[model samples]
Target chain A: MTATTTVLISDRPIDPDRLAADFRKQTAGSGAIAAFVGQTRAEAGAVKALALEHYAGFTEDAIAAIVDEAVSRWPLHAVSIAHRIGRMAPGDPIVFVAAAADHRRAAFEAVDFLMDYLKSEAPFWKQEVSDAGSRWIEPTDRDRQDIRRWRSAPHSGEQ
Target chain B: MTTRILFFGQLRETAGRAETAVDLPPSVATRSALIDWLAKDDPALHAALNQDSVRLCIDKKVVLAEATFSAPNEIAFLPPFSGG
Candidate 1:
């Protein structure tokens, strides 16, 4: 069967538990499932909210491309990505990615790979609103380094 | 022809607006030329856009500053991404 890929960008809150359950149902026959959820950090009351902005169609396309790359690189059954845009308060879910595969290794690696690319390459801009002030956030040097690891090592199933 | 220019993230803050339409002069044909033209009147915008980390996209596709086309419909200035 052809691998299924789902990508969604929501302005509303994302329920990570619901997303995981739905992915598990969709990829029922897959032997392993791996998932990751990112949440807005409270920063000890210093940060009040996070505002995320995306280039309507462009952001989704960028994420879909990353999903396609992940599917190609791994022996996967399905992949699902959900990201939240607009203003979000602390403790809110920011993003979720789940991958299903026949083995544990493929499932684990795909989620990791998807996140690294999303952090640095996706076209979403982020701003943090804090008690002191608001400031735009960009990918750190560590983020760049995280993504570089994939480029330096060739995956087994790479085209 | 009027080309729509979009600024995102810190560039949006620096530009003071999300988007603007500019009618290109004859000399402002290339992407680099367009940046120079836009930066001519605004020092803050020039400084923000000239940063090495900023990227240019033509019609939603990232392109080099030297890339040239006539009367493109849209051009966007994107700062580095910070998504999760």
Candidate 2:
């Protein structure tokens, strides 16, 4: 079956459970499904809000490219990604990724691979608003390291 | 011809605006030349754009600084991405 991919960038709130359910239905015959949801942290009251900004057309295209890479690397049946733009309060969902494949390992690894790339390389700017002030966040060294691991790993097609 | 230049993330903050349009001169043809030209009046913007971490996009597609094009509709200066 041809892989079904859904990518969305929204200014409003995202419903992770709803997206997961919808994705589940889309990949019904797949043997496994892996999903991840990321949320803004309150940071123990230091953070008041988190703001995400993206280039209208370019950002979506960049993310879709990453999704395509993931599909090419794994034997995925479907993938869905949704990210929130604009201001979000603490506890709000920031992003969601789900992958379905014929086996558990493929589904699990695809979701992990997608998130690592999204955190470090996706075309979105993130800022943490706090009582002190707002500051733009950059990818940490660990984030870069996480993504680098996949660079050396052999892809399914390459093997 | 007029080219639209964009700044994102901290670059946008440094530029004090998200985008601007500039009419290019013949000398300001390459991406590096364009940055120098744009920064002629704004030192801080020049420094921000000069950072190695900053990437250039021409007409919505990321390209190397050495890449050259004529009368491209858009050019964006992007800082390192921090999403998810």
Per-chain TM-score of candidate 2, chain B:
0.92
lDDT of 2 at A80: 98
- The global Cα lDDT (0 to 1) of model 1 is 0.90
Q: Model 1 residue A38 lDDT?
A: 99
Q: Which stretches of candidate 1 lie over 4 Å from their true place?
A: A156-159
lDDT of 1 at B18: 97
Q: Which regions in candidate 2 have their CA more than 4 angstroms from the true location?
A: A156-159
What TM-score would chain B receive for each of the candidates shown? 0.90, 0.92
Among these predictions, the greatest lDDT belongs to 2
Candidate 2 chain B, run of 10 with poorest lDDT: B23-32
Write the residue-wise lDDT of candidate 2 on A1-159 in tens digits: 578999999999999999999999888999999999999999888999999999999999999899999988898999999999999999999999999998989898999999999999899999999988999999999999999889988573334
Which tens-of-lDDT digit does each residue in A1-159 have in candidate 1? Answer: 478999999999999999999999999999999999999999998999999999987888889889989988898999999999999999999999999999889999899999999899999999999989999998898999999989987594343
Candidate 2 docking DockQ: 0.89
